[model samples]
Target: MRVSQSMKPENAAKKLGILLEAAPESFREGTVTRDELAALQADPPEWLATLRREGPHPKRVVAEKLGISNSGLARSGITDPLTTAEIKALLAAPPEWLVTERATQAAVRAEKVRVAERDKERAARGASDARRSGGGGV
Candidate 1:
């Protein structure tokens, strides 16, 4: 059966081997971004399954090894699943994926700062109201 585009990103990401822990920023912003797996459906189905059997980076290397264009991997609906060891290796030297890691960290920190600011603002508003109400005492 064919998967519909209406499927959620988190679900699609899982099928694509993403292991999403939280909602994506884009999705939270009222956009329906396709998960990596669904986006790859643009490619042929047979090719994607072939890549899954091969391994990670299978699209590029497997295709090269098989004498097919990398694009073929997308059509085949294949996704390279990351092992725990591989995840550890990538985190140890995240520099290889510089742009993404840095941007992710920055976004997280920004969100934290935003939350802190909001909390402070709310506290100030509460204090002002309390003072106006004569400390809520008899």
Candidate 2:
């Protein structure tokens, strides 16, 4: 388990199989070590716990957090995780792109729900129609 003292935080996070953007500031502040990296994988610290809770998350997590899809993230050019501070800041003063994406996400969710309900109604109608038309000579 060899580790360089001057290893970049991002590289260290990569070595640890974690996204640096998802890591807490404390984790980024400290120099990464093989032992520490292994320890984090085996047993995480407070910073690690925080990172797990409030993430610079994976693409899936990011999408869910933002209520948007990966395609939205791509369209918005959001390749990195937004920190809690960053998230708050954006919420306080959302950019046009963020606003637009949120609207799109809302519309998408609404459409999906509407489609599901419609499908359910159609299925129910079909079942009732089958029962009504199920006439056979005794």
Candidate 3:
């Protein structure tokens, strides 16, 4: 994407891989030059340095990393960005909430898989019935 001054703060933050909350107030307010954006991506400022250690992780990213849901993050009081270490610790020693959230995630994934398989089977059955009926297009 062509980085331009017209880009919004959120877009700039996404491009730089820093969270909007992690970026400085000035950065959040002003438009960024392409060069500035590139520089930020290449070498984030001191404030963003901590984001490097942890992240500008959004809710989805954080949840996926922690194997939890957005609500789970809230229940765990993880309202802020978490470092890789914190995520690792949670994984290494699963808490009740973490265990529960992981199960939920797993169940959601399994259901999606099952639904996809069922859809595929239905499609195949439809195709077979169409072939048997000899109605394979006029």
- Where is model 3 more than 4 Å wrong at Cα? 1-5, 14-17, 24-26, 32-53, 136-138
Model 1 clashing-pair count: 7
**lDDT to native, each model:** 0.50, 0.73, 0.78
Between which residue pairs do clashes occur in model 3? none
**Ten residues in a row with the worst lDDT in model 1?**
58-67
Clashing pairs in 1: 43-75, 44-75, 44-76, 47-76, 48-76, 48-77, 48-78
Which pairs of residues clash in candidate 2, taking residues 3 or more apart in a chain or in different chains?
Answer: 22-56
lDDT of 2 by residue, 71-131 (tens): 8878988777666666667778888887888899899989999999999999999888878
Give a tens-digit lDDT track for model 3, residues 4-99.
556788887777656788667898896877778778778777877777567757665678788777887888777877666777887999889888
Please, what are the lDDT tens digits per residue for candidate 1 over residues 9-91? Answer: 55554455433333245533432345434456566255444434433432344334333344443444435634444434644
Worst 10 residues of 3 by lDDT: 52-61
- TM-score for all models, in order of appearance: 0.31, 0.61, 0.70
Highest lDDT against the true fold, candidate = 3
Deviation from native of the Cα of residue 124 in model 1, angstroms: 3.5
Ranking by lDDT: 3, 2, 1
